[model samples]
Target: MKLKNGKMRKMMTVSLAATMALGLLAGCSGAKTPVSNQEKVLRIGVLYGGNMDDSYFRQQYTDIYEFDRKNVKIEIVPAINQSDWRYNDGSEPYKEPDYLDGMKKIMTGSNPVDVVVTDVSVLKQLIQENMLKQLDPLVQEDKFDTSDFVPAVIDGIKDLGEGSLYALTPSFSSSALFYNKKLLSDAGVEPPTDKMTWDDVFNLAKRLAKGSGKDRVYGFSFNRYMGNDPFWDMQYTYMAPLQLRMYDEKAETMTVESPQWIKAWDTISNLVKEEVIPNNNNVNYDENWTPISNDMFLSGKVAMMISESYYINEIADANTNAAKIKDYTPVDWDVVTLPTHPEKPDIGGNIYLNNTFAINTNAPNPESAWDYIKFIAGEDWAKLKSRSNSYEMVARKSYIQPRQGLSYNIGAFYNIKPVPPTNPKDDKLKQEKRGLYYVENLGRTYFQEVLDKKKSSTEALKDWSEKGNKMLQEIKLNPKTEFQEDGTPYIPEDNVSAAAGLSSKG
Candidate 1:
């Protein structure tokens, strides 16, 4: 598929959380491979999108399950047309999939689809629609062992089912607060602890950030992928955990003029002004005005950052290439649970489960489907998949370990629980008025105005709310109205402020 410049990169970055497959299947010597009464075809449904093909799906399941051993055949059913449900970030407006009808057709017949696999978002929808069979009865009957699974993964899935087990996932993706041990020690600051509040981290950042231009060290970065678009950066990372509301209950009006919104904007702008966090000013543009580098965290110049498991690969790769590159230092880092809101201290907003599996309620071979689910979510699968350097975290807690010769707080990835899904209302609004999705982008411009000191935080939000309300009205009246910002269209890029002196060149 053809994409505009930078669109491919952005799409990949946005889908990073959803990209990794369960990617594992393991063989056991003493395992009793369950079989159907006859040689029945175990039809497996995958939430399909992007370029993932049926062959890839076959490899993911067939290799591990050893269907031939059980006299079974594998068939892949694409449950949805676009797997955009995987995009949990609000960057794109939610598009409710019509998979419910598709699900009915595939899941309700004498020879119905046996298994369904999907991300947690669609898993919730499947459960609510009664398309999935609760696994509790199967677990009890088979005496399936689940004690080795990560508490967060098992508990989070149960929470989705309101204290029931409707599905099981082999792996999860989550963000953790990683800090440079030496940087904090050298700066005479205490290392950040697990579950630190955003305010706590920001205060420490204020203390640790020091020096001017070239030699300056930043205290914290929300993520290593901070872009030149401050409004998008703030909205995507910093403000997201706060759960700031962008629209009313009906999503037909703006809701950003509240005191809470003003406080959030002020807090973000103040951090930028104080240089406690990396902003556009921290980056260097080349002669042609192209961004060169923004990975200050990797250069050992940023004290702390919030990133997912994929970043570990980047860091390892950077370290291996450090000697070949100029003036680079290998970073000594460890991670802890991501910062939490004071009111919701146990919640981690960055946790995601993308490889969930469940049996169809009307499966032709429920026993065989149960066997497949257990095989994937079992300990052997985690053990094998964990050894790979994939950007996903295995659900079995015991299998998770540090890099071969390294030791760090690996528990940080799964210790904190995920924030509950909040897309039901948003989904309803999107179906009613598709244009309501563009309202948040409008706020980005006003937010940048506050950051640039062109407008007071309160005034900026008030103006933003006025404009947003007007746009929502237009969208409600004419659902096809296009949103046009006053200035240039913002194209978000993957650039962050790097350490000014840590040149990529030798």
Candidate 2:
């Protein structure tokens, strides 16, 4: 996971890709003597989260590179930045740029890269700009089995066209309702069920928050940091599943003003008004609300919280004054699906909205890069990658089934069953909590606008529709074009250019 190690591995992959391209180009051009092995080296650009040692990101990059090296020669040049550069851009010159800045570096860097890997927000921007190479050729060549990947993940990678696929998502995170089993049992409350509605959750919240003043224990803790914090979390967890569509796919419009959205807003507002959940100010004090919520629950101060499944380990390990979580040996906490709206049974899990991989349009070795892409998304790599990260869920449906020789029992955490033996558990909680239906940042804004009471649900939806359409229009109309020093436009299919810009919207 070390940054240096990642950088080294990236260099190796990029070098190999370059080597493969040189040899391939020689034969295609009918050169008498093919290019020597020394001339072949491929460059790949990658922007990773956290440090190079970040288990999930590191394992992903390493697994793919190692797996592909045996079959193809390639080098991966990774630009690993520990700090997020986007946030630091305007405010602090000394600090790192946030996610966007980091992505731009990988996309527009001087080095010749065959593939670029990063998050959806960055990939979406590249896609809009037509910076990514269409992966249909690779798919047709049978380099990878696209059908093995989950439908939701495939949908995420495809453009509007039926055959177009631009990227691949290997893993992602989702939300779940985590509850302290002992506390719920002590209160004589039936553990939450997957079938529970928001109203049912509210009743439990009211019962859990019975004590007054200092002795009071709230039902849930949530943050409201405009777009990133509780705003998005609540939207994905509470609003979207209510069948509130933020944007109309066909019309390319926002629908924030819908009555369903209004109901969602009013429900959250009521919770705040009744003190069932902490207000925005209280929750915002902590940078990340999950830890605070975990602490509160582990300490026997809160009854339940909605959080990422990865937090289960932290909660089970945390120390608390009311009851030492560790002394209980193995913790007795359980996950439940986030409450659903009465009318929206189909709506549940959020989709993966994190880092995905795309071929750079200008990559020197497209074929070999596709090979690596296939390897990364293949069964061998998927199984190895799954064992390396606790937070990530493999996007391939085949990999989701039980696998032997894994370092940990990952299936145990994901194949969770509901408590109290009520009907078939269906493992809905695990599915929903595995990056199944994520709301975008723009979607989050609509939720915030509604929650803040600044706009009616209908009005918010209208605004979102306008903004989303405008953005999509800008992307479609402004096709990205690479140019030469002579100022002539460069078409990707006919020309090879060292300098190119990949553009797409988040």
Candidate 3:
């Protein structure tokens, strides 16, 4: 999440009001000193997904800041976790306020902020609460064209009501299955097919699990917490092929109890119960998912794992700790889209995770803020991000290109077709891999929440279907509004029935 200037100052004003009432004017006044016209600083709040020095985050910040420093008068005050914020200057690191506190600090300030950037979900909350400014008028006056933006990315940022657009998605990612070539070969089984079903994966896991008891190797591992929401992740990756829609379009209700969802959960439960997968205790973040899956694959202790594309590179490139597995020897392993359910071949889509950006409604200078937004969305930014250590596929259709010396391919895959520039070098491998797409995670939250309660699969699905529809209705009933004289819009009471009346159309 990133914050632009205008909203931060507003939050600051609101936060200081009580202090002013209590006669603590000295502190509030000190914090509200205005910046001189000569000092043009853009204060932004950002969520650090990786190390501050990480190439992807580093390059994005460098490019934007460098451009802003020279091309426009600007100061960038970034708010990130203190431990994560790094700079050569001796200044202390920034700290994140709790959600409400942060909102108050930015909303009611005397020296109001200029602009803000963040995620769609956060922006949605602010927009509904009348804490954000609509970018539509600014875009219209500035003639900002969205033609170059990906449709899916744009759709992800729009308010559920279709009338307003609150944020811009700059980049995106989806998860896939990463397997160890040596392990599969040693097990006498071929690599899992792009079209394999969950049952097929389970059978292969049985074949791949090796060793006994204390020395036992398990076939698969995933996080298990009510908060973890494997139900949504697994359903999107596996049941998508079954064409399972949790919410009915015409009826406007959840369909989680559908046969497809039940079947998917039952399959996972069987795997857990049968010991085909390691027990939950074996699934620690350090050992199971993050660097561990990579470690296990490299050491031949695990055959295949479900993870993002970035993890594959991290494992294969490790020199000191994970140099043992034959597959970890760069160029030995490969990636394919997550397997789909057998019945609904077209059901699942790519599960894009991190590639997103949003605007703060409380921003002071949205016009100038767009300059940074446009810069990050350009070809140069995409190329830089793609080449960074955390190599992510660019979201734009025009930015795909072949880079020299890199062994792993970086391109989009939808239903097994490699959508890349027509290069002969890229053709042969296209047939072996497929790409899947998915809706944003928010769309599936209901099923996830229900599943966490240890409810029957059928009950969870039904609950999600009802709750999802209710949420949709709320969004539909509450259309976005222009700013009022007070810089705030009147908020309606929570009305589930009113929200359900909303159409899911754009």
Candidate No. with top TM-score: 1
Give the alpha carbon lDDT tens digit for every residue of 411-454 in model 3.
32323311111111121211211100011233344343333446
How high a TM-score does candidate 2 get? 0.57
lDDT of 2 by residue, 401-469 (tens): 322322322333223211111011112221222111222356566656665778765676666566655
What is residue 248's positional error in candidate 1, in angstroms? 2.8
After superposition, the stretches of candidate 2 with alpha carbons farther than 4 Å from their true spots are 1-39, 47-60, 63-112, 146-148, 159-164, 195-197, 223-237, 240-262, 280-294, 318-330, 341-345, 348-351, 397-506
List the lowest-lDDT window of 10 residues for candidate 1.
1-10
lDDT (C-alpha) at residue 284 in model 2: 27
- What Cα-based lDDT does every candidate model obtain? 0.69, 0.52, 0.46
**Candidate 1 residue lDDT tens string, 212-285:** 76567888887775354556666655566566778877767788888778877898788887878777766432
TM-score (C-alpha) between model 3 and the true structure: 0.53
| Alpha carbon deviation, residue 461, candidate 1 (Å) | 1.7
Comparing 2 with 3 on lDDT, the higher-scoring candidate is 2
How should the candidates be ordered by lDDT, best one leading? 1, 2, 3
